[model samples]
Target: MTRKLGLAGVFLISLAVMNVFADRSDKEVVKRVNSIEVVALDSVEGYEKKYRIPDENLNDLFAEKIDSLLNSWYIQNVFEMPSGGGMQDSLPVVSIPDSVYIDRLQAIDSYVDLSFNKTVKNFIQLYTQRRRDQVEMMLGLANFYFPIFEEALDKYDMPMELKYMAIIESALNPTARSRANAVGLWQFMYGTGKMLGLEIGTFVDERRDPVKSTDAAARYLRDLYKIYKNWHLVIAAYNCGPGNVNKAIRRSGGARDYWSIYYRLPRETRGYVPAFIAAAYVMNNYKEHNLQVRYPDFPIVTDTIMINSYLHFDQVSAMANIPVEALEALNPQYRMNIIPAKKDKHYALKIPIESVAEFIDNEDAIYAFKRDEFFPNNEIINPKSSNSHHVSNISGKDKVLYTVKSGDNLGYISEWFHVRVSDLRYWNNISRNLIRVGQKLAIYVPQGQADFFASVNRMNFAEKQAYKKKTPVTKTTSASTQTSADGKYVYYTVRRGDNLWSIARKFPGVSNNDIMRWNNIRNANKIQVGQKLKIQSRS
Candidate 1:
C-alpha cells in the first residue's frame, strides 16, 4: 500500500490545485454570485454557530427598528431617522473612482490590511450607492457606539479599525437581532454571548447591553486573532467560526490569507471580509460621497446607578420624573423593563446624566412605589377571599369578540389581545388602523384562553392597563388576576424548579420573608407546583 509519489504525479496534483483556486476569483464575485448554488453545510459537523449578516443591503433593519420606536424623549429626540413619507434623501450622488477608494482606505491609519480588490469595490458600491440611507443612520449611531467599542478594543490591544465591524454587524443598533438570533451591536448568538460571559435570562439579555457586548466582541476577536494571527482571517472567523475558517484553510491547500481561502468558506462569509472593508470605507468616506450624517440631537452622556433591590421602570419613572421609555431605551438589556436586582446580586441602571442625583435622592420611594402591586410576594391574601373562578382548559378556535372602546386603537387592541397589529387588521379585513367605539373585532388567541381574552372587553381602561402590566409574567400569570371585580391580588402559580426566594425575586422589593409571611406558609420550602399564592395588587 506504500508507494512513493513520483515527480510527475506530484506535479499533476499541484497543477490541479492551482487551477481550482484560479477560477475562484473576483471575475464572478460581482456579476455571477446569484447563480452560485447555495452550499449545504449539513455534512460539516461540530462547527460553532454562525452569526452572519442577513443581507449585504442592510437598509430594512434600520428602517424597521427606527419606525417601531414609541414616544420616548430619548428615542424620538435622540435618533431622527428619515420618515420616508414622501420626503426624498435630498443629497446629490457623487461617484468616485476605484483608485480614490483605494487611496482613502490607505490614508486611514489601520493595522489590518485594507487592501483594494474587485470584491471589496463591489461591496463599497453596495454601501455608498445603494444603501446610503442606512449608511446615514448608522453614521448617527456610530457617534453613540464607536467610543464604547474603541475603549474595549484599546483595552484588549486590538486594532482600532475593528470598530467599523459593528457597522457591518448591526449598523450600530444596540438592539439589532439577526435571523440567527444573534443579538446586539456585535451580532452575538446566545451560545457565543453566554460563552463570553453575557447574562441571558427572562429578565436581562446582556447581549443587547452595548458596553458589555462590545467588550465581549473585542475579547472574542482577540482570541480569534491568537489563532489565525491575521485580522482578515479573524474577521472571517467571527462571521462564521474558527471551525469553518480552518476547514476553508484545509480545502485551500494551506493558504493562510482571506482571499486565497475565500471560495472555500460559506457563501455568506465569502462577502463578510469584503463587507467589513465596505463598512470601513463607507463609514470613513461617507461624506465624500455626499452622504449627510444626521447625528443624534440629544447628548449621549449617561450614569449607571447600582440596583440592589428589584426595580420596575414604572417606579423609576414615577419617582424620578423619567419616562419609562427613556429608561428602556438607555438599558435595552432588561427584557421585561424591570431591573431584577436582589440583596446579594446587583445590576446597574443607566440614567440620563442630569437625573443621577435626583434618582439617588428618591431611590427609596422609587423602589417602594406600588411594590405590592408589581411584586405580589410582598402581601399575601387568602385564596378563599379571592373571587377567582376556575379557568377551563378548552380547545377549538378560541375567539374573543372585543368591542372597541373610545380610546382604543389597533395598536392598543392588538397588544391587549397579545396579537400583532397586522394580525388584528388581517383578521378583521380592515386596511387602516381606524376603528369606531362600537366596532367589533375578533381576536384569536391560543386554544385554551378564550374566556380570559373575552373579559378584556368588559374591563375599564385603567384595569386593562393593569392587566397589561401582568403580561410580562408569560404563562405563570393567572387569568383571573385582573378579572376579579375587587382586583385585590395578583395570583402567581408556582412552576417546577421554583423556590420561595426565586419566586420572590420576580417582583421588586419582595423578599422570601415577605412571601412566607404573606402566604402564611409555615416553611418556605413547603410550597408545591401549581400552588397559587396571592400577592396584593390594589384596584
Candidate 2:
C-alpha cells in the first residue's frame, strides 16, 4: 500500500510540472505582443501638457481613449509571446501579470478613467513654457486650415482624421518651409512635389498654394495607400519615403505591419508616423485638452476668377474691396504679390465671392492705377536705364551679354561668374536653372563697396579687438577666416543657427554658390549647422 501511494504522489507531481510549462508558454506569447510600442499616447500627453489644458474631464476622456486603443488584445497579441516548454515550445505565449504589461495596461486605463487630470498632468510635464506658447499660437491658426483639409480629404474619400497631417507638417502655416526645403502645408520636398504635379518656380511654388497643395497631398496619400495597402505605412512613407519604408520592411525580415517594422526605420521616420497619429488623436480631442479654436479673421466663402494679365495680388485686393491680408492668405503662392509673367494664359484668381463682380468692373482701372503707383519713377522701372547707369558708374565693368551657349547651364554660368545659380536666377528672373541656347543672360560684375566688405572682414576685426584687449593671438582661426587666402577678406563665421540663404543675403553680391565655393562645398544640401565660409566682395 505504501509503494502504491508513493507512485501516485510522483504521478501528481509530473502533472503539475506539465501544467506550469503550458502556462509559461502562454505567457511568452503575451510578452512578445506587449513589446510592440504605441508612441501616440505619450506624444498626445506631451502636446496636451504643452497646451495647458485645464479641463479635468476632457483630459480623462483622451487618456481613456488612448488606453483603450493601445491596450487592446490585438496589440498584446502582436507584441508578446507565449511560453510553454522552456525553449521547446512551438508557439510562444506571453507571460501575463508581467510588470511591463500590467503597468502599460494600467497606464492606459488611468488615462481613460482619470479624465482631464491625467492629460493636463501629462501636458504640463511634456513641454516647456516657450513651447506651450507656440502651441497656443498654432491652435489659433488651426481653425483656418482644418476646414479646408477636412473638405479636401472628404473629396478624396480619405479619413477626416488625416487632416492632422497638415498640423504636423506646418502647424497649418501655408508658408512653412522645412530644413530640407520641404515647403508649404504638406511639407513636400522639390522632387516629391514635382512627382505629384506641383509646379515650382521663382514666382510661385504650387506647394504653397493651400488648395492645390492639399489636393496633391491627397492624391499622393492615395497612391501610397495603393502601394502599401495600409494607411499607417502610407503616413510613414509621407515623412521618410516609400523606398525607406520598403527598406525598413526588408530589414524587419519582411514584416508586413507598421509596428513590426517601425524599429527598423530611421529615427525621424519612426517618430514621424507616431507624431502624425498623435496629432490626429489630439486634434479630435482638442476640446478635452482645453484647446479652443480661434476663428480666422476672413470669411470662409471665397471665389475664383481667371486672370490673363500679369497682375499684382495687392491690386486685385484693392479692386475687389478685399483686405490685402485676406487676399494673401487665400493666395500664398504669389511670392512677390505678382503672378508669374504670363502672356496670354489665364491663371485662377481667388477672391471673396461677393467681390468678384466688383473686381471685374474695376479691372482696367485697377491695373492702370497699380501701374502708375508702382512705376511712379519711370526711370527706375526701365531695366535698360538701370543697366546703363550701372555700366557707366561701377568699376570692374565687363560688358558681356552672353546668350546661353549649348552645353552651358546655370551651374556653368554660376561657376564662371563666381556666383550661385540661385543668385543668377534672382537677378535675372530665370525661373529654373535650365537654360537653352540663344537665351539672353545678364551678368553683373559688382564693383566698389569697400566699406561693406570691410564690415565683414573678420581677421582685421578680430585682430583689432584682440589688440585692444591686450590678449595673446592664439589658436586656429574659424572656418570662415581659414577659407580666405590672404586673411584680409571678410569671413562670415557660421553660427549655430545660420543657413546658406540667410548668410548669402547678409553680404551684398555674395551669391549662394559663392558661399559654397568659398567653403569648398560639393553639395549645397549637405551643409552642417556650424560650417563657415569666406565672403568675397561682390561690389
Candidate 3:
C-alpha cells in the first residue's frame, strides 16, 4: 500500500497549496510548488512602479473659489452676522481674559506648539464672537469629516490635531478648489496630488475623494514630519512648500520655530498656523463659545462596493429609487457622474448604508437600466470639447455665455439651462462642479437669443424682482404669461414641485434654455415653489 499512501500524500499537499495561494493578496502568481506558489519576482516591483506617482507637469486652473470660501469662513466666524443674533446672547462678547486663554493654551495636549499670542487671540475672537454662526456650521460639518480625517491620521500614527489643518485648507468642503488650482479638502496642487498617488483624470480626481485624499494627506504629513521633526515647522512647510520653508529658514538664520520664521513666510502662510490653533480650540470648546454642536445630516454610514462594469449614475438612481443628486454628492470624485469601470479595472462605488441592500438586490437591473441615456456608445465624455468657456455651438445653434454667480453648482445650472450637467462640463472643460463665482461658462441655445441673454444679465436686482413677480393663478398655455409692469419681460409664478427642467417641458419653444437666458438664471434648483420665473412671452 506504499503507492496508495503516496497518492494520498500528493492530494493533501495539493489542498495545502490551494490554501497558500488563497492567502496571498497579490494579483498574479508564477508557479505552484508542493504547498506554495512561487510569486513572480517582479510582481512587487511592478506594483510599486504602477502605483508610484508619475513624473509629469500639469497646468493649474486659476479660480477664486477657495479664497472666497475661506474669506466667507473668516467673515462668518470672525465677524458678526448681519442679523445680530449670536450663540452668546446672554454672555458678554469678548469676555475671555488673557489668563483664561493662557491656561487653555497650557492645557492643550498636542505635539504642535500651542502658544498664546496676539495672532492666536485675534483668531480666537474670529471663532467665538464674530463668526459664531460660521463656527457652529463648521462644527456641524466637522462631525462628518473629522472622523474620516482622524481615521487616516490614526492609520499613519500621526497626531490627531493635524485634522484641524484641513479646516484652514478647505473649511471641510471636499470639492474646494483654490485660486492656485489646489483642490479638495486638503487643497493639494497637481504636482503634490499626483505625487501622493491621487488619480487626476478626465472622469475622476481622487483628490476630491474624501477617504482617499485624507489618506494621502496623512501620508504626506507623516513624510513632512519625518523631514522637519517638528509639527510647527511641518505645518509651515505644508503651506508654503518645502522650498519656501527652506528659504524662510535660511532667512531666519536656520530657525526651526514657526514664529521665528513667521515674517519670512508668505503672507498667507503667516496666518495659517494661528488659524490652525484657533480651529482646534474652537472645535474642542465650541460650547464655551456658545456655538451649537449639531451633527451633520450627511450619511454617516456608507458602504463601498467594487464595480467592475461601466455604469451610469442614472441607472442606480432609477433602479434603486435613490436620487441621482444624492449619488453624485456621495461620489464627487466621479467628475462626469459616470463611473468608468471596465472589466479589467475596478472602481469603488459608495452607497448609503440603508440603500446598500437595495442597490445589491437590483444590481443587474441597475446595470442595464436605460444604459444608452446615461452613456451613449460607451464613449467617455470629452472634458475639452470647447476651448473657450463662452459661446458653445451645440447642434449648430448659437450659444450664450453666462457668468457663474455665487451659490451655483452643476445641478442647478443644468436645471436652469435644460442641459445635462455632463454637457456643461464637456462645454467648459470643467472636470468638477467646483466653480468660482466669476468664471464664465458656455450655454448653447437657438440662434439670435444671445443678445437677449446679455440684456437679462444686465438687469439690476430690483428690475429682476419686478420682472418675475408671481401671480395667484397658474396657467396651462402661453396666454397665461404675465407681462411685467415695465412691459420689458414676462413672468411665471412657480407652483408646487416645480423645477426648471419640468417647467421648461410645459411651454412650447420656451425651454429652460430660453427662460434662463432671458432671466440671467444659472442654478435651476434654486427656484422655489413660490418663486417667480422670467420667460419670453409667446403671445
Candidate 4:
C-alpha cells in the first residue's frame, strides 16, 4: 500500500505543469494548514539560490555524510596553505652562498629554471616557513602519488621534475577544481579535458580520475614543450593558456625568455613559475626544514573490478561490506555516487586489495541487493537547460534561514537542522555540496519547529563563535576496548560518538584499514551506534 501510494504521488507530481527554470504556478495562492502559512517552491522565482550548493561540494558532502567510517579514505587530499603563519615563527633562515645555490641548480638534471631569483626565494620561504604544514602533508602524499606521476612523465619522456607541476596545479588532489571550473590534479578545463579524449558525462567525469588525468596532463605538457622547447615558458603557457603567453611574448617584442616577458604576463602566472620551482625544491629537501611526511594509514594497494551493469555505491557497500565512502574516494569519477552501466558500457570499481575475493564471491548478491532503492524512477529534467535541477516539495513547510559557520558543510548543517540533504539542495536549487562560511541558507521545516531556527538566528557572530568553542568535539574510547587477544577476533559495540578512525586507534595493532577489511565496513552510513564491529588482532 505504501509503495502504491508513493508511485501515485510520483505520478501526480510529474503531471503538475512545470518549466525547466523553476517549480512555479502563474497565480500566487496562499495555503494555510492548522494556522501555519506555507509558501510553495514554484511560487518564488530563483528560490533555489536560497539553498545554493557550490560545484565543489559533492566530495565534501560524501565525506560529511560518511564521517570517518574508513581510515584515510581521501584518495587525494588537496594541499592548501594555512591562511596565516610566518617563516620567522616556524624556522630560521639559513644563509646559503650564491655559488652553492648556482652549483645546486647546475647539478640538477632538469630543463626548468632552477635559478635563485627573488621570486623563487620568496616562494621557497613561503613553503619552508609560512606553509610548512601544507608542504609536510604534500611530502607524505608525494610518497604515494609521486611514483604514478613519475611513470607518466617517464612514459612521455618529460623531465622528472615536471612531476612537481601537480603540486602547483592541484596539490595532488584528483578532485581539485578551480573557480574557473578547471579540474583534477592536472586542473584541466572542460574543453581541454574533452579534447585530450577524456570522457565526461552525467555519470562519470574522467577529469577527477588521477591516472587518466595525469596521462592527459603529461601529454599536454609534452605538446607545449614541443612548441616552446623551454620548460619555463611551457610552465607559463600551462598556467595562463598559450594565447596569453603568446600575447606576453608579443608585448615583450617577441622575447622568448619567461623572465623577460614576465611583466607582461598575468599577476597570478607571474607567481606560478616561482611556486613550481619552490615546490620541486621543497619536495626534495623537506627533511632539512624539519618537516616529516604525515602519510595516511590507508594502504596504497587496491584492485579494480569491471562493472557492466548498473551499480550504486550503496549496493557495493552493503553486499561487499566495503564502506560506501571508500568506494567514492577510490572512484571519484562517478558523480552522484552512481556507476551508470548501460548494456554496452563498462565501468571500473576499485576496492582495497584484500576485498577482491570477497567482492567476486558476493558479486551476484551485490547486484541483486536493493535494486529498487539504488535506481529509483529517473527524475526528469531539461537536459538542454543549465538551471534544470528542481525538486518539488508537496509537503508545505515554512522556510527558515541558517547562517553557515566555519567547518560547516551541507551534511553537517542538514544533520543539525534535522533535514534531508535533498531538501537542503532543493530549497537552495543547488546540485553540489559546496557552501561558504557566513553564507545564509534557506531550510524548510514544520511551523511548530520555526522557533528552533529563530533562536539560532537570534545569536550574534560572537555568541555563535563562543558556543562553537564551548562545545567539545573530540571523543575518546574506553581502555577496555583497546586490548585484544592474539589469534582471535574481538567484537566491540559501536557507540554513538564512535567512528572508524577513533575505533582503530583504540586497539594498538589495529588500523582502520584492518577494520574495513575484516568487517567489510566501508560506508559511513553502514556503521551505526550499537552495531558490533569485528576487530582482528595483528598481535
Candidate 5:
C-alpha cells in the first residue's frame, strides 16, 4: 500500500540551494544542516562580507573525515573524550620554529628520509593548528592500535614510524571508507584487499579487521620497498600504486629519488608523502604544541573465543552481557554482526577478558538463543551473492517540481531535500553547481510526502524559514509502512536500534535503497518511538 500523508496547503522550499556568485542579484541563501544555520553575506541584517584565498595546488586530495572517524562504533560506544577542562580557553599561540621541527625530525630514529620541506611544514600545521581536537582523538585511539601496528611492522623488519601511514590513510579509523571505494584503517581497495589475501565475503570484510589489515599493509609496504628501496618512492607508490609511481619515475628521466620525480607524480601523490611526514611529526611532538592525549576507554585486556558455528552479535550481547556496539567495535570484520563460522572453518570472536570464561561456559546457549530467526533455514544469506542488490521492478522515486528560489546553490537544495547533489544535477540536466532563480527543477522523491518537498516552490522566504524549523519533523519521519496490495513481499517497520544496514539484513535480496524508498525517507530515517517494523513474507 502506498500511503500518502494528508499535508495541508502549498507551503514551499526554494529549489535553488544557493548561488556562489556574490555579484549576482538573488534572494538570500540560507543553509541549514541539522541545528546549524548559515546565511549568505549581505543576505542577513547583521551579516558582514568575507573573502577566501584560493589554493589550486596542494588542495586536500585526501580529505579528512574526522566526524565520521569519531562516529565509528569503536569511538562512539567504546571510548569517551572526557571534557577537556578550560585549559584550552587560555592558550598562548603555540607555533614552533621550522628549525625546532627539523631538530625533532632528526632526533627520531627511522629508515624513512623524514625530510623537511614547505609541503611538510604546511601539513604539520594542518594537524597541529587547524585540527587539534581531531588529532587529540587520534592520539587517544593510537593507545590501542599502535601496539598492534608496531608488532606487525617489527615482524616485517620495517621502520616502526611507518605506522603513521594509518593516521594519514584513515585517521586510524577502522571503518573509514574513501570516496574512491578504498576502505578500512589501511584504506585497501577491493581488488587490492582481495589480491593481498584479505577476505571480503558476505558476512566478513577482513579489510576492516585492524590486526589483519595492519599485517597486510606491512606486507604490502615491504613489497613496495623491495620494488623501490627508497621509502619516499615506496610511500608514493602506496598512494598512487606502482603503475603511477613507475610513470612518475619514467617522466622524471629515470630519477630514483622522490624529490627528483616529485613534479612528475600525480598531484595527490605529491601531497601524500608530505602528509605522511606531517602525521609522523604531529603524533610524536603533539605535547610540544599544547595538545592533550585523549584516552580510549575500550578494555585494555580482551580474550578471543573461536567459533565453529554461525553466531550473531545479538546472541553474544544476550549471553555474554556485551553490548552489540562493543561487539561491533571489537569485531568490525563481521560486516553483518555475524561470524559465519563453519564446521570445517572457525572464526575468532573477541570479548572483554572478564566475560571470556562465562562466554565459553554458555557457548551452546549463545548459538541457540535465536538460531532460527538469525540464521534462517540454518544458512547464511550471503548479501554479496548475485541478486543481493535489489533492483525495483517498479519505479522508486516519483518526480515533483520545485522552482529555483533566490540564493540557491546546488549544495543547499540537495541538503534540504535529502538528495545527493550529483543526483540533483543529473536529474535536472544541470551542467555546473550554479542554479538560476525561478528555474523549475524536477526533484524525485518517494510519494508518501511529496507534498512537503513540493512546498519549496510556493513558499516565500519567511514561509520557508518557518517550514525549515524542522522541530515537528517527527510528524513526517513517523510515516509508517503498509504492506503491498497482495501482501507477498516482506516489509519491516523501523525499531529503535534498527538501522538501514541492520534492517536490510533481515531481507536477503532487499537493498538499503529499496528500504529507504518504501519508508518515505531520503537519507537518514531515524527509528523514533512511534515507528514500527512491519514483518511480511517475501513472495
Candidate 6:
C-alpha cells in the first residue's frame, strides 16, 4: 500500500507540472495576440491624431508622428526567428495544405521574393536586446490596429489576415513614413493616394484617415490581385508598383516567379514581399517567441455623422461630452479642427456611438459657436452672412487658387507670397477658420506678384542646382539638397530636432531621395538632431 501511494504521488506531481506549463503557454499566446493588436491600433490612432492639429502646425507634427511611429514599429516587429522550443513545440504545427502550397509556389514564380537577408537579420538582432522583447512590443501595438484593419478589409471582401501587411509596410504604424515618401499605414505615396481618389491638400490628407485610407488600400490590393491573379505578385506590385513588376517579368523571359527576378528588382522592392510574409508568419505565431501583448483600452465601434459645413473638433467634443483626444482619434483626416471648406460639402464625422444623438442635437450650436469664434468683434450686419463667404473662393478671375499639401498653412503661404494670414483671410472672404482640397482663394496681391513669385522660385531653383554640383556625394548632405535651374542651388540647414521629412517638405519638388542625395545620406537612422542641410521650398 505504501508503494501504491508513492506511485499516486508521482502522478499528481506530474499532472501539476503539466498544468503549469499549459497555463503558461496559454498566457503567452494571449499576451502576444494582445500586443500585436495594440501596436496596430495605436499606430492608427497616432496618425489620426496628427491630422487634428491646426494648419500652421500640421507639417511638422505630421512628420514627427510619422518618424516616431516608423521607428517604434520597426524596432518592435523585426525579431529573430525563434528556435524550436518552449510553447512553440507544444502548439500544433500549422500545415500548408497541398492547395495552399501550390498557390504559394505559383506566387513565388510570379514576383521576386525580397526576404530579409543576413544583413537585415543582423541589424534587427543586434539592434534589439532580446528578439522576444521586440516581438512583444510590436504585438502590444497590434492590439490597437487589427480591429480597424479587419473591419476595413472585411468591407471589401479581402482576407482579414491581410491586415498584417501594414506591419510589413509600416509596422502597423499609421503615421509611418518610408524612405520613398510613402505615408500612413498603407505607406501610400502622394501620386498613389491621388489615383485612388484620396484628397490631399492644406486642409486635410485623406491618406492619414484610417478608415478612408484602409478602404483605398483594400481597393488597390483588390485591383492588383485581379490583374496579377496571384497574392505574392499583388504584394510585390504594392511595394514596387505594377510597372516595375511587368518589367521584371519581361526581363525574366515571362517567368512569373519572385525568386526568378529577385536580383533584378530594386533593392527595396526585393524585400517587400518577403517582409510581408515573414510579418504574417510571426504575427500569427508569436507564442513561439514568448512575447506578450497588452490590450488596448477602447471599443471597436464608432458613430459617423454627415457634416454639411466646417466644424471644429473641440466644439464637437465639448457638445458630445467626449474627450478631445477621443474625437481626434475617431476622425484623423481633418488637418485642422475645421472640416473641408466647401459649400454644401459632406464630411463624414466619426464619434462614439453613444454620443451620436447628443452630437446631432447640438450640431447647430456647434456651427454657431464656430462662426462666432471665427468672426469675433465684428458687428452683426443687417443682412445675413451670405453662404458665398463661407464657400472656398475657387472661382472669380482675380482669385489665386491653392490646394493645401501635407505641410502648408496661411503663415507658410504668407511668408512665401509676402502676405499676412489676416490679409489672406480678408481677401478670400473666408470665415470659420476652415480650408479644404481644391479650395480656391482670392489673393488681392499686386498685379506683378505672380511674376515676382515666379522669379524668386527660379532663383531658389538655381541655388539648388549649384549646391548639388559642388557638394561631394556625402550621405548626410546629399539627402537634403535639390537641383535647381542655373548654377545656383537652395538647401535647408537642418535645425536642432529636425527630421528628414520636415526638411523635405520645406522645398518644392524636393523628394526624400533628393534630400538624401544632396546630403549623401545612406541610412535614414544616422541623421543627427542638429545637422544643417539644404531643402527645397514647398511653394
The best candidate by lDDT is 5
lDDT value for candidate 6? 0.50
Point out the worst 10-residue segment of candidate 5 by lDDT: 1-10
lDDT of 5 by residue, 377-468 (tens): 78876432323322222267667888888877776676456555667777888886778998988878765547556665665543342232
Runs off by more than 4 Å, candidate 6: 1-67, 70-144, 295-299, 341-343, 375-539
Please give the lDDT score for candidate 1: 0.64
In terms of TM-score, which candidate is strongest?
1
Per-residue alpha-carbon lDDT of candidate 6 for residues 257-304, written as tens digits (9 for 90 to 100)? 554555566655655554554455556545544445422222224667
Give the Cα error of residue 286 in candidate 4, in Å: 0.4
Q: What is the C-alpha lDDT of each candidate?
A: 0.64, 0.51, 0.62, 0.61, 0.66, 0.50
Error of 3 at 97 (Å): 0.4
- lDDT (tens digit, per residue) of candidate 2 on 141-202: 56556777778888988877677667656656677666567888888888777767888986
Model 5 lDDT on a 0 to 1 scale: 0.66
Q: Against the correct fold, how does model 4 do in TM-score?
A: 0.58
lDDT-wise, the better of 1 and 6 is: 1
In angstroms, give how far residue 118 of model 4 lies from its true place: 1.2
| Every candidate's CA RMSD | 19.1, 22.6, 20.0, 22.8, 21.8, 22.7
| TM-score per candidate | 0.60, 0.48, 0.58, 0.58, 0.59, 0.47
Model 4 over residues 1-539: C-alpha lDDT tens digits? 00011111221111232212243344543233232222332343333243211111122211221122111224322211222312223566666554444444455566665644556655666667755655665665676578888999999998899999888777666666666788777788888788888999887899988778889888888877766666888888788777777777766566676766767877667777777876777777666667755444433457889988887876787687665546666777887777887559887888867578888999989987766445545332223232333453637766788988776778756644555577787778766787888889998766555654455555444333222211111224343244356637777788754666546645543555457667875443357877878887432
Shift in Å, residue 491, candidate 6: 59
Please identify which of the two predictions, 2 or 5, would achieve the higher lDDT against the true structure. 5
